[model samples]
Target chain A: MDHQEIIPNLFRTEYRKIVSVLSKRFGFEQIEIAEDIASETFLTAAQTWGLGRIPENPTAWLYHVAKNKAKNHLQRNALFEGKIAPEIKSATSDLYDGDIDLSPENINDSQLQMMFAICHPSISQEAQIGLSLRILCGFGIEEIAAAFLSNKETINKRLFRAKEKLREERIEIAFPEPAKIEERLSTVLTTIYLLFNEGYYSVSQNKTLRKDLCLEAMRLCVMLVENKSTGTPQANALLSLMCFHSSRFEAREDKNGELVLYDEQDTNLWNADLISKGGYFLNCAARGDQLSRYHLEAAIAYWHTQKADAKEKWENILQLYNRLLQIEYSPIAALNRTYALSRANGKEEAIVEAEKLKLEDHHFYFALLGELYTDIDNQKAAQFFERAISMARTQGDKQTLQRKIDKFRPADIPD
Target chain B: MDQYLLLMRLDIITKEAQPSPEQLQVYMKQYHEWVAGIAAENKFVSGTALSTEGRVLQSDKVPIDGPFAEIKESIAGFITIRAESFDDAAKIGADCPILNGEGNSVEVRKITSVNENG
Candidate 1:
């Protein structure tokens, strides 16, 4: 990459490393301080590198500057805690690398610890995801706002309050105790799942890609799977499910950037490599008898990649969704299961179950009803599609509903 | 070749107005491109960046970190470049990214040699 792109990319990649390592060293209470030092180091780079004087070793230069800045900060702020982390304090100027080890393992370890801290249940879920995006993912405030579909001021205030809460609670950045690791990992996985879902499903366009959010979630999940202590079967299942979804991410959007229904999507666009990776993680997850919502969801997603409209695939998907609902009773999950029922059984049985859902406010409900009644009752399908069109929040969904409505009355509708 | 000094005075960023890391990266890219453009023309000489935490020494009073009580901007840094005239240096200064900020300015002056080596 050219120098123009280098620092920004580095900021994306190394900013988290430096910030996490610093937070890990000093704890969350000093996180804002750590961020200040990291930001200053990059600012110095921005100005110095502007003169076409990029240092021979850029990473080392960052380390050197960060080391100096940390020392300078500690000196200026006499109100700092009486004891400083010894590792950073005693290092000589030339031996700055000794101060903060930016080794790959260290970086991962620190980020993992931070993930757990940021996802702590003490804070609100929105704050947890916001902090994760900002502190662990190196996302800017504006980027976080785009991901959340909120403005910068709201995101900034949310983060500021979250940081204050962490400080107030004296939250530690160390990994959870051995006994609590499983419990803690559950919350972390949920945040990861939510993050992935936001990226995979959000309709907010123009700034941050929904694809990036899913990829970031997968990256975090990989960290959990790589570490022996945290890599539970559920984590593997979650990763597998994400891989399957991401494999078809491109297929979900057409050239004109319109949403494609799953059944109508061109199978040729599916990524074979990600599909196989998803299968690999599923195999890893099979090592344990402990089933999770993720395992069932992974199985459902696996069937989706088969790309066949066969009864066998639909039957297996129905079974997995069946098991999924028993464990988790989400209205969306039930709605999905009803669709599987349509494919597995027939439209009549699916329509009965879907109508019972009474999800009047959800556009997807009307959209699904429209699909079910298409073959059984064309007039009802058009009415349901019309209802969906008015209620759908995204233009993509509204257009898709209109297309469904158009299918019934080609003569009456204009092109 | 005549040497011209570009003295930069920039507005200080308070805590409330601190630029985000992403914003810093964006600014850095622009500045890097500008410097590279000058270097490509073979007019770039050398430059230095000043730390905000600086002390001003005076004979009568203890050193202070400031431009002055009345001044709202401080010397940010400077760069020297080969130029034919003051106007030529001004041409380069016109696009200096630092000047993007309010109250920021680049004062272009010719660097005159005072004495020859004995």
Candidate 2:
């Protein structure tokens, strides 16, 4: 890759590494200081490399510079002397001479710790996700704002408030004790799941294809599974669920950036590697007796990955969805179960169940009603499709619904 | 090769208003990329971002606590580079990543070297 390409790739990969390392050394309260030093380090690299050749070991160069910068910060700042210095002095008298541990093991530990710190239950779920994107995933504020479909001012205020909460709580950037990990693990898992869903099912027209966030969420889930303490059955199940969903990304969207429903999607576009990984993790998840929503969802996604002509795929999906509804009764999940029912039994029975849901404000509900009405009544189908188009939040969804409406009505309806 | 000085100034009207960290990150990245491009062309030598707070010396031999009240802009930083000519230096300044808005710009000028012996 060229300089431009390499810099961004490095930013995605190394930005977190450097920040985690510095944050570990400086302590969580001075995370901003760590971030400043990391940002400056990258800026220095860009400047030096712009005028000259990139270093042979660019990662090493960054670590070396960042390490020195951290040392400088500790020595110069009076705040560090009060809390961090005594520990440093006790650990090593000559902080400058000795090599501070930015080892692979330490780096992983630090990032995992930072993840827990960011996902503390005291913070709002939105704030936790925002922090994850900004601090853990190396996303810019603008990117985070786009992800949430909010203005920059709102995003900035949210981050500022979240950081203030972190400070006020005096939260430490370390893994909780073994007994306490489970208490916060569920929130962390939920945040990761939301992050993945944001990327997988974004509502914004401009940012419909943010595979970066999905990948980042997967990476964090992998981290959770790798660590002995955090690697529970649910974590593995979540990873498995993500792998199954991500495996279908290529087939998820059409050329016009509109979603292709599962039945209409080209199965050939599914990723074999990710599907296999999903199966592997699913098996890993099954080892325990505990069943999470992730397990049920992964099972549903897995069935969807099967051949369209398979006799049992829809049946299996319906079963999983039924179980999922019992475990976690979300309206969206209920709506999805109706789709599975349409495939498993028939549209006539599914429509009866779907109508009882009375999800009046949901576009997908109207779209599903339009689909169920297609064989029964063309006029009603067109009306439902029109309502879906009107209620749709994104241009892509609106276009998809509009296309469906167009097919039914030969004459244009007056607005 | 002739030496040139690239002078930068802050055009921001509200001196007390600090940039959010996000905005700062964006500007920092832009500045780095621009400087890197110049360095790739083998023009960059040395530069440093000046602190916003500084003293100013007046003609009356008094070091006033300023960039004075009347000053609309203050010199933020400078970088020295090797350029072929004044025109070449000016051309290079076009890409300098000063935060653009009302009056942000890089003033490029050829610098005369006084150390003849070297």
Candidate 3:
């Protein structure tokens, strides 16, 4: 078997199991050593497995190697201190009693515990996500540093210090208590969601979609859904929301790598399988009537995916946005809802609703407002487009707004 | 071929300066162990430990007791190593035992063998 294709997933899952077990056995301070040993194990397998047929059970083969690497690491440390444990020597010499718990359920539980530990709110949100990507997702410090546009040394220092703090505090590798689980779950879900978004809309020059991140997020959410103790209505809602959005992944971008907006996208290119799965998750999310923001967002996305024409879907989207505003009152939601209203009720009603939102500092809000006013033949609203052009961060966004401004002729200006 | 110095600077100011005699002995042992380790690894070159006392030689060949300038990073020690390139020298310098203690530093430099005698 081509181990390269399977190694990353195996490494992520197996490494977490090994680290969690070793951290419990030798204390959290030794987690770095565990990670190093785990890395060496994969390196060994990458070198060794290619020369011969892959083992009968690749996971078992990896675990055996990792366990031995861990033992060797401990023994080397002991030898460096001029002391060696006889039991460790015996265990290394005889691999009979070193059976690792490689069960899928056990592995998932360990990974979930590790995720919780990394996302502990006592740590900064930046540190939490950085550590989670490192420990749970198996992202390297250099990869994460690049993502945050920082140096690798800074990322390494942050991870080192964060782990030290967790060890000092004796942070246990277990799920958060029930009362605090809901609050903690939101942060974890947001991290995973953002990870998927980064993969979906990659900032890197190489490729747009980082399939690894998207798959990892989905796998983690699957773990959440399977666990009876932690699975909640919001978890299902977020997972469904991700699935609905990801269903359009195949059609989101064209052959030349240009983004195709949802209205212009080829619906035939959408993954029907993913759409069905998303629908299933949406139904699961409906079991609880608390109505999360994700639930409303998923409902809106489902409506868009189901509709054949943009004109038929605007009213439902507006209603979903109204419900979303009632649950989570945000300026972005109001701006979005108003845009939908513009398509449903005439430009005048949309502009009236949009004016109520004081979002002068937001560039896209001004751009949307300008577009709405321009549709109503109000050339005076070019000022908002000019403001948007000045505030725009990306060249593409700036160009788009400038084009809107160019369409407003001075001769047709309203005083 | 042109040559450049690969220097490793370390800060030595903090609350842990005034160590007990026993602690100083342990620190010395650790340092020596590190030095031996580097030597065994064949990366060690010429270097020395400096005392806290400040000394100077005047132009007239007279010894002078000097407080020196109020500098934060006083030269603790240094080492010389031969390499085909500056990168190689820097890699060798990275293993220097002088960096074992907290806030200690090891600076490396290339000796400019200019024909000043001519």
Q: Best lDDT goes to which candidate?
A: 1
Overall lDDT per candidate, in order of appearance: 0.85, 0.83, 0.71
The digit string of per-residue lDDT tens for model 2 on A1-415 reads 5556667768778888888877877788888888899899888888888878888888888888888887777666645556555555454425654545678898899999999999998899999999999889988888888888898899989988998899899999888888888878988999999999989888766543378889999999999999998998899999999999999888988887778877788889999999999999999888756888888888888887786655488788888888888777888998889988988899899999999999988999999999898867878888888888889888878887887777765643324
DockQ of each: 0.00, 0.00, 0.00
lDDT of 1 by residue, A1-415 (tens): 5557778888887788889988877668899989988999899988888888778888878877776887566555533664546665653444434656667788899999999999999898889989999888888998888878899999999999999988898889989999999899999999999999989888777423688788889999999999999999989999999999999988888888888989788899999999999999999988756888999899999999996679999999999888888778888898899999999999999998998899998888988998899868788788888888889998988998888776776643333
lDDT of 1 by residue, B1-118 (tens): 6889998887653555445889879877888888888888899988887766666778976988655435667777888898888898999988899878777899998988522110
Model 2's DockQ score? 0.00
Selected candidate, larger lDDT, 1 vs 2: 1
- Docking quality tier of model 2: incorrect
The order by descending TM-score is 1, 2, 3
DockQ for model 3? 0.00
Model 3, TM vs. native: 0.68
After best superposition, candidate 1 residue A29: deviation in angstroms? 0.3
